[model samples]
Structure formats: C-alpha cells, structure tokens
Target: FDVTFVNKDNLPEYVWANSWGVSTRLMGALIMSHSDDNGLVLPPHLAPIQVVIVPIYKNAEQLKQISSHIEPILLQLKEMGISVKYDDADNRRPGFKFADYELKGVPVRLVVGARDIEKGTVEIMRRDTLEKSEAPLEGIAGHVKALLEEIQTHIYRKALAHRQEMTRTVDTYDEFKKEIEKGGFILAHWDGTTETELKIKEDTKATLRCIPLDGDTTPGVCMVTGRPSKQRVIFARNY
Candidate 1:
C-alpha cells in the first residue's frame, strides 16, 4: 500500500505492498549514480546500444572494405541477442564518433581500420574503464559478449564499493550532525518517536531515510534521546 502504518484513533495498522513498474526516476538514478567525468557509464545490461562499431578508413574504398568485413561480425552479435550499432557515416570523423558514443554510454566500442584489418584484429574499448586493446576478429563476437558481462559486473562492484565507503556509523547526535554535513548515509541510533525524528531534522537538516531492513540489528540506545532503540536507522540530507 502507498500508505503504511496508518494510525486511526490511537490504533495502528500495517500495510505491506510494492510497486511493480518503473518510472523516469530509474533513468535519473542510472545517470546520476553511474556517470563520471568522461560521460555516462552505463552498465552493459542497461545500455540501449551495448556495442557500437566505428569504421576508421582513409577513403571511400577503405570504408567499403571495412564495412564488408564487419558485416559477418555484426550478424553474429545480433544472432546472440546483443544490440550493436555500426556507425560508418562519412559526415562525422572517427574521433567524433568515439566521443559521441562515449558520452552516450555505449558499453563496448570496436574500431577497425585498414591496418587492423590487415592484422586480422580490431581495437576494442570499454566505456566503463576506457581501456583499449586489440583482439582477433575470428571470435570477436564471443569476446565482446564476455567483455560486456565483465563490464556489467565491474561497474556494479565499483558503485557498491563507493556506497560502502560513503556510509558511516555515528554513536552521538553531535557526531551524526557532523557526519551529515559531509554528505552520504549516516547510520545512527534513533528513538522510535516522531518528536525525536522531527527535532533531529529541524536541528541538522537530515532526515531518516530508512530503518534498514537488514544487517547489524543489535540493540542500542537512541543517540539523541538515550531511549532504548532496537537498531540504527539511515539518515542523510538528500540522495
């Protein structure tokens, strides 16, 4: 239910519910949480274009040859249910395409020039790490599939690590106030009362984000009121 733990005439009732669909908030969260200096850093599974192939060539003939070579690779990737984009438009340069796709957060990018074709390889770059390497074109599709999974996992772990680093535990109201100013989640004991919660918010401008559903639930006393508290709640200025 949208409204939980409603109180009526000094009586309380619980409502357990969930939201099934997603909204624009999911998109906002994706961009805000994962983006960096270069641009968006989308997880592979979430990226609309998981892989973008950019052709590097000196002339029209070279572009035609490169496109012909990449046709089979593109078909292979598509057959494996991977989204791919082959951008060979002469209107834009290769560097511009690279930067555009990087900003768009394409998970993986493959660059194949005449020289790379002669060597039977392509230059691959990962958006999350911006690391580039050359890989043979023979099994390039499978290599890309594996690399996408790796990128997904790497970005997820990186974001989790950042969250863990930002979370802090505070034992005193004064410490909570100090920590909240620095930004990030603060774990602090809170008396189960509206008065104390409101007072803390009024004084420090931090709100109780949640009474964490799991983890270290050991009993403790409220930092602000010194009342017996069951567990620590999460507090933050804003997400």
Candidate 2:
C-alpha cells in the first residue's frame, strides 16, 4: 500500500501513481519460522543483549558491594565484544525482571546476590534450555561467552528440527490432501502446469511455496495431473 499525491491538469486528470511493498509479510514469516512452546525465542546471535545480569541485594551496603564485584565482569564481557545488560531496576523484583527478559528472548541470564558474592559463584541461566547452573564467578567472562554461542546454535537447531518434523512428501493427490491438512511444507510431483496448481490451491487452500532448488529429482507422476515429472516441488499454506 502507498500514499501519494495525484496530479491533475487544469481541466482533467494528468497522472496516477501506485506503490507496493511486502515487508510485513516477511515479518510474519520470521515469526512463524521459529515456533516453540515456550514462546518467542529470537536467535542468540541476533539479540542485542545476549546476556542479562540481574543483581540481588537487600540493603545499600550489599548493593554497593555487588555493584563493585559485577563491574569487572561487565567490563570483561564488553572487552570480549559480548552484548550484556545489567538490569538494576530498583522497583521490580528479580522474578519480574527474569520473566520480562525471557519474554524478550535474552539468551543468557546471570543472577548475582549477596550469597553468590560470598560463595564466589554466580547463577547462570540459559534461555533456550531454561536451565540454571552455579558456576565460579572468577573468570566468568569466558563461560558466558561460550554459553551464548551454545544457545545460538541450540535455538537454530530447534527451529530446523521443527521444520524437519513438519515437512511431508506425498506421491499422489489423495496423499497430498492428507499430508497438507497437517499444515507444513509438502513435497510432491507437479505436472508443472499453472492450471493444476491453481486447481489444487482452490480445492485445498494450499499454494505452491516454491520449487525448491534442492528438491528431490526422482521420477514420479504428478500428484494432481498424474503426468511424468523429474522433481518434487514444495507446496504449503503460507501467510
């Protein structure tokens, strides 16, 4: 959609303009590409704050000491070029901040408290696995950096695994209907005609997503027209 000023001649219409962009559809595709039950989880490498550090304290002195102890770790992370955030919100409790960051998809969370400082350890939480482990605070920069990389790979694999599970290959039109109803990428032979493509779309509400560059080329009859074909194209219902 576009907004434009239409020009007019002295006594008649002179020019008309039209514009179009499909970026919102791209955003919708990204949102659906990674479907997880835990909610929205962005790729770790793409997130601004890969690690969020939340300080826990009761009194002013504890807060001061915790701040001092965390300074070196934060500086070390910065030097290593890791994106990190120290959430020191005065009003909200630690639990609230934890949920907020997870919803925002922070890959790792570091919880530091008076006990952690005394014990010389910090609680490290991974967003992908939602697992927490206590690790030594000394030289924590390396641990945090490695954890970020692991989470990055983990979420990506999770998305790939989901896509693999949802993908289906069908040999006949009947089989295509059964599989496509499950809602995912369907690989099937096409007679390669625009008419059959539109007919199947009108019948099943599934459209040709793409003729995958790496699609299977084994010989088979088209699912709709039963004509000889070389490769299986991908069909699916997409927004």
lDDT of 1 by residue, 188-234 (tens): 88889999999998998899887888856989999999999999889
Write the residue-wise lDDT of candidate 2 on 1-239 in tens digits. Answer: 23444456435343445333346765565556653566556677777788899999998899999999999999999999988999887999999999888887788899999999999999998887889999999989999888888887877787899888988888888888888888989999998899999999999999988887776888888888888888999999965
Model 1 residue pairs with clashes: none
Per-model TM-score on C-alpha atoms: 0.89, 0.86
The numbered model that scores best in lDDT is: 1
Q: Which candidate leads the pack in TM-score?
A: 1
Predicted candidate 2, C-alpha RMSD: 4.9
Ten contiguous residues minimizing lDDT sum, candidate 1: 14-23
In order, the Cα lDDT scores of the candidates are: 0.92, 0.85
